[model samples]
Target: MFLRPEDAGTVTSPTLIEAAPNEQPVLSGGVTLTGWRKDGSNRLGLPAAAQGQVWVADVPMVGGRALAFRQLWVNGRKAVRARTPNDDNLPRLLTWDVDKQEAWITATAVGTLRQAGQLEMVLHQMWAVNVLRVKTLTVQGAKVRVTFHEPESKVQFEHPWPRPIINGKNGSSAFYLTNAVELLDQPGEWHYDGQRGQVLYWPRPGETMSSAHVVAPVLETLVQVSGSLDQPVAYVQFKGLTFAYTTWLRPSEQGHVPLQAGMYLLDGYSLQQPGTPDKAGLENQAWIGRPPAGVELAGVHHTRFERCQFLHMASAALDYQSSTHNDAVVGCTFRDVAGNGIQLGKFSDEGTETHLPYNPKDEREICTNELLENNLLTDCANEDWGCVGIAAGFVRNTTIRHNEVSQVPYTGISVGWGWTKTANCMRDNRVTANYIHHYAQHTYDVAGIYTLSAQPGTTITENRVEEIGQAPYVHDPDHWFYLYLDEGSAGITVQDNWCPAEKFLANANGPGNVWKNNGPMVANAIKQAAGLEPAYRDLLAEQIKKPAANGAQVKQ
Candidate 1:
């Protein structure tokens, strides 16, 4: 994340600007692309189907690079990245070798492409995705062998649990190749080739290059509220604003191997000795890095965001990075974010061991007393399968209430971290009265409400969860639940939640967890009052499209 020290930040009320009561302000982080030329008139070679339909533009160089970006926005909406086997016809993995970090596939499935190293293999596992960059592709007669670039190759093959699952619960895992010039056969798709220093696009219907407002994101963060533990930025409030069009560039530079909840692995490997001093069954060690956010906060106290819109961000929409307390994110709309909608507290530090419990000597290091209430989170985590609607890690005295979360790919809400049954600085968090549905769009081993680690006095109650979306490519169709408390989840009382059935999970739990009246038997009145108490129901009427099971967004 970039530190903008020159920006105005102070305790003085006038120094911080707030939008007028009736005005809607938008803070955007995008650059417009210009000078498009038809591929039929240019010398660039395209596929037969894309000859007259494609358009090319010279990529403006920035610091000796071809304008680093992962996504494009045409007419205020996202354009699909060029991928082979276009939408939903993913090929199944034949075999994967763990030792050599290689995968074999049917030869003819991937046509003879020119750029072998640029192809990215997106393999869907049980709970996450493994994005492997192809290093070499050797095609024999009937079978093709592909190798990956490191350290993603080590992290993809050697990581534990969700690593490259071949034969899963039902069928084998599926994958597809993307980011090659040969894959630009469909309209409304785009590709950026660094070798040629240009970008190519096949426009959608009714989109003309002369009038299309195409935006390419260059900055990772639009706004940042930063302070220190000693003197925090306090009593600042923002209202009626929109943050738009920011993209993260780390995944395109170094490989992205997610651990869980959109936290990528810096380095990870399974432990030979599966025991630690805190927990006896620990089997893995990992160091992780967090994705960027459009709006970030650190060492901020008593800050709030109200009636704001977060859109077109490549990573998380909003994040309280660390040492934030008594902050509230209320009545906000988060849409089209590639990562999590709301991320609070610390998952794991880049240099710290992931499984180890965190209890900083200074108590301010832990996030506390956060309020995430009455927000509308939709169409987020659409690309990152490891992310969720709301993710809170190592937070204390926080309350997540009366939110509506839909159209996400993984878990609706995930709380806590460390995955250990030991005590630390997390307790008394409340997740209550939220409506979560249409989740698990493309991945499984998830739930509407999930928890981890040993939170002392947490409670999850009166939430309504239903309609786990189907995706035929998931590893296990039956691996989902309405409410789940994973390893070391203790001192949590889950009661009075309404779901379709009695589908819940408590895997390798620790102690002192209580469950009561959480299924179909729950009272109708409790279910009625579960999500978005009367005033916030207008959020659903904004025409948010639901993601199809085939990984495409369609009108609901």
Candidate 2:
């Protein structure tokens, strides 16, 4: 029998309270829960409930093994399991100070006010959520002097920029401005002032504060099956469960400027740092770092997550880390996630050292034999722009096939990690039969399918990618490509792919890679390779069409 919190009546409903005049309502009275907090800090103790509640259950173990209970249902709807205090709604910016990188916003009077140290700023951009830190917020007469802590080097100004547009056009540039607490200026907007210990909100036009059913996320993970190298968690199956509302706590060291899709580590380092030899062999080299995922799996084997739903998460839905072998995430739906949908392995080239060791003959270790198939990943990378839909770093013998990924901020599928062609453990990874499109909407130097390093047995086949937009940087065109083999990558095969893009393929010093039967003209060949009968051609055609709802777009 599937055990659930509701089955035993362990879940409690949040207590609702009336809103003060001109303020938002408050929801309280939920139990506290504990788990691993974000920011890689120490494991959190029993934390107090914020806008959401928590439930704890004790199940009798059999033979000293813990029971696996993995679902949280709330009021008949499957509640999402998130990190902490979800940021589903963001207040609009009232005014801007482009020079100081500050913004003006208002907060309604409601609930417990967040302190300065507890608050973080999130800028909703097209395809990305730029998470920032509030340096100083000084309330003036009507507005707050909100100063951001971003380094001057990270900000893109109008003149004398490294890459300038000769046409004097208004490219998508990072912008911000200051704040203060006053009467709710607009509907569906909220503001929090730590100095006054107040949270204010302006409800949507037809919405009432008293009738609002708020569900804030208080948990970081719904299910975790961890084992050590000596004893692995093998042969576990998690099927037909919906996991939601995992949160990403704001880091203490703020000023997290994203290069793309909230991938902050990719901000400073460049593949083309002046003195460094151009490793990728591209005229312009812009590379960044990778982050962790929400559903972390380490030192486990033969695990399967089938027909699961992962939504409203603060980070990547699934992450397979060290010693994770022969795992599969099949027929799942990952939507509205803050990071990537699936992350396999870790990025090899981290820290200041740019060079990586070459081990052409070393056998694959840590991660192998993974399969990700028939999943729908959409509206991901909501908070981090640098993340992709499916990211594989230093993994071998992995298969990512028959998935549909769209409306993303950066690349759709990213494989391999090392910048140079130096051989690592990444090999024999296959990306096939997926439909990817409407991505690269915010940042730059990306594609529908992007690969790095020299993975000898990598093959990309029969995928359909289209409508990749350009980066916000200057001197770049308004469109990207379907495939990118970057930075000394080699021995890969790109075959029978249907890419109706202005540029079908790109290579950055990648050698010994083969491209066969690709581009729009090869659509029929791609269909045939993917085993789609002629009768199913129309269904495939419809699947390639852009989705109706592409989530929020960056306001020009």
| Colliding pairs, model 1 | none
- TM-score between model 1 and native: 0.94
Using Cα atoms with residue i matched to residue i, what is each candidate's TM-score against the true structure? Answer: 0.94, 0.65
Ten contiguous residues minimizing lDDT sum, candidate 2:
545-554
Predicted candidate 2 versus true structure: per-residue lDDT over 1-556, tens digit per residue: 1222222211142111122444321111111122211212121221232111222222323247432211222221223222222332323445655556566555331112233343445454433345555666666545555555644224422111122122223333332221222212343433333333323333344543343333333345545556656566666666655565554544324444443433444333333334344343323233334454556677677777765666666667778867778888877777777788888875543353323533434243457899998788888875566678888877888998888888887889988765676656777889998888888766555788888788887899998888776544422454356888876678899988887643755556457799888887776756544422333333334322111121211111
Q: Which candidate number would show the highest TM-score if scored against the true structure?
A: 1
The TM-score measured for candidate 2 stands at 0.65
Query: How do the residues 1-556 of candidate 1 rate in per-residue lDDT, one tens digit apiece?
Result: 2333344345565134456876656677777788887875543435778888888888877678678788988878899888878866678888999887789988866786644757888788878876778888888788889998877888788778666666767678888888887788899999987788888999999999877778887778877888888767777777877788888877766778898999998888888989888878778888999999999999888788887888888999999989999889888889999999999998978988888888789999999999999999999997788799999998999999999999999999999999888897889999999999999998899999999998989999999999998888888888999999998899999999999999999998889999998999999998899878677777667643222112221111
Runs in model 1 deviating more than 4 A are 1-16, 41-45, 542-556
Instruction: Show how many residue pairs clash in every candidate, following the order shown.
Output: 0, 35
lDDT of 1: 0.84
Q: Each prediction's Cα lDDT score?
A: 0.84, 0.54
Local lDDT at 108 for model 1:
66
